[model samples]
Target: MPIFIDGHNMRGISPTDLEKIVNSPKDNFGITHLEVFYNESEDKLYCVLDAPDEESVWKHHESFGLKCEFITSVKQIKTAKDLKEEKFQILGEFASQLSHDLRNPLSIIKNSVDMMSIKYKDKLNADIFENFAKMDRSVIRMNMLISDVLNYARTQSLILEKYSISEIIQASLEGIKIPDGIKLVIPEHDFSLKCDGTKLQVVFYNLITNAIQSIGENNSGEIHILCMKKDDIIQIDVQNSGPPIPDEVLPKIFEPLFTTKDHGTGLGLPSCKNIIEQHHGIIRVKNNPTTFTILLPKDVEKLSSITV
Candidate 1:
């Protein structure tokens, strides 16, 4: 679990009012309050808590009839960024180390399972084989999530190149299994983009996979893609005709380690945002048709003027 620092705006809040809520008996919400800060000039309260998820933090605040202005998950310390040239080095190092440590053991286990499957195929029953298949799938998913974490932590510069939009999209859809009856409309545009082709491929892949999953179990849906280039910038839109994302969840969808799915690492959108911003590009989502729009500059010289 990670620690989250949430901010709340309370008008005319007195010290006793804050103390009373802070001193209240703790419950089983799995929320531990570390500290609270009050700014007299602005009349804002900042609270830091350690909890398993954001919902628990919300419930902890509601337990005392307190209203929250907003809550966001905290990452590494920013104070170091002001003092040094690099930021989040310690945090990134920890994530990379942990990912490396986990990968070795997972690989060994997967190899062992494969060997057993081959050695005991005649003796193993159907139920045992099914469980083995499930394990292999879990291992593959875990490996993917580890790679996602490493990619998110990377602060390296981009290796930009000139590539066509059609080429990028085609490469991204290589192994993605789109369901039958699902229509994907990709316009034949002859636009060339100067960016990291591999990283951009990742962005499109995630958006496409999410669109495919958003369609119900029936797998009957339509995805519309539109691309345009003007004013020295290229914009790509991916829209899916499926259930719209919840209104409340739209704000927190890009936060790291925040997810609505049962088996998600919550790093997909965050990584996408990081990679795009590193290239001086912008990514946004809109409802009504559930579209993801990516805007990128055609030349690297304009990177300084573009604000991430």
Candidate 2:
């Protein structure tokens, strides 16, 4: 039986648009089951490809400015589920239970911080106040983990929305406190496309954030963005100057919980993959020893205003 994807209300377009995305090259990877993407306006398509292992998914999608994860079981090929099942798989279940159980202590810490604020109202040193803030950040990180587990355990139930692609990137930059020294190189031309704001934001954010992190503190790099119209489709390329992503590690970057960063959740990039696939867009990441680039081809209605 064909996998009946039920994201009707999720997409901000018509069913016919989705049918077009489904017919794109990426959707017909000829695999028993694979991942594909569509544009919010329903005009473009991209493929994530199917491999015998999860490592390949990471390597393939990463080249497109997207991310992926590693799968250890045959059940992973099924479209209905992915990383979500792993959250409750044997020992994974216990880990989640433990993370959830720790919430009580985090709440207590927050409460204690509140109490200290009151008890030392006027006498609290600036240093002490700063410590409370530190504690707060720690609590937030823990909560983030719990949320990741839950999200991973569930199919994002992809809530696709028709959104302006260009605006999403700008919006992401606006809200994020980008580290200093890294400069964002905006495209010289105006380009617009449609996609889910939340998911697409993740896609741009992860790529941009990764570029900044690659150079570390005090180091500066130029991040360039190129958005253009290729006939009826939209193509986006984000390039950064930094150390090249090692050819060996490139393939496994998308696997869940796999990360080169010590504190990485390994979910940001993977989540990006899911969102792009749903949008009927293609994403690829590449490097030339000193520069890195990501590619995304999205499908959206060719508006007269944008066509010229």
Candidate 3:
């Protein structure tokens, strides 16, 4: 069995009532509530439990008419108290330092390429000029890879603010150069969401970039972004007219370091998943015409206050 820590907003629920609920018999899902922690001032409750999986924990909470803000899988450290730090924390620190070291040289190379391109444009042959262009692109690609690594390794704090869906999407599109043959359709019915706008921007940027790449250069295609609000959740779908992803590849698309592209770092989708999960939301994909759907809670209070 895996252990999970689930947080809930317990406003208006008394400690006595919560205890009575927790003491009730375990449900048929085989979930065992191991421990409970409550903060009266914050009206926050955290439950440590042993369960089959995250979904099982979700179902267990749903049965109690409670909504979990976030559910995280964790391991209990019984022996080494000093080694309680998470492996990802170490990896994040190392990745930050490594990115800093690598970017210094990368910046130099990029500047050199730009200067050479301007100084030799008239002197170089078409083939040589094309090679310079490729070099410049490679530098840009390397920079993006470094950013992906940092984004995945580090757990960033969300700076929540209210922003319209259309505003965020437009901000994401500013840096991307859509091909001439492709058409982008954005939703006219916009909804405002309180979230980490910068993180959500990264999610949209990666999804749109992937969509454009999937359509391929000089290929005519349409990428449509749709947004709708239903009940307490807001759903957004990014659909692209690209070839269907293979069945085997579909399941692993969000996995880290999994990619079919030769030059891809494979961190884009995984980073997007991490950001969505941090927001206490869900992201899924469907193929027939290749659509990625994201479901986010309309009420930001459902999200845990813990950064990332």
Q: Return the top candidate by lDDT.
A: 3
Residues 1-308, model 2: lDDT tens digits = 22212122223445664464445444222334445565457443444444545444444344444322232333324444644655436535665677678879888987887788778879988998867767765665565455455444444454545666567778656434455788877777665555456656656766777777786756887778777767656666777778888999888876677788887878666656545555545556677633333333344322323322
Query: Model 3: per-residue lDDT, tens digit, 1-308?
Result: 78898788887667666876578566547876557898778779988888888898877767767788898887762445445445546766787688868989999998998899899889999999878877876775666556667678754567788888899898777557788999999997999888888778778988998999999968999999999998667889999999999899999999777899997878899888887877778899999899999987765766443221
Worst 10 residues of 1 by lDDT: 80-89
lDDT scores of the candidates, listed in order: 0.79, 0.58, 0.81
Task: Rate residue 237 of model 1 by lDDT.
Answer: 94
Name the lDDT of candidate 3: 0.81
Extract clashing residue pairs from model 1.
Answer: none
Quality of model 2 by C-alpha lDDT:
0.58
Better of 1 and 3 by lDDT: 3
User: What would you estimate as the lDDT of candidate 1?
Assistant: 0.79
In candidate 1, stretches whose alpha carbon ends up further than 4 angstroms from where it belongs are: 1-91, 98-147
Question: How many clashing pairs per prediction, in order?
Answer: 0, 25, 0
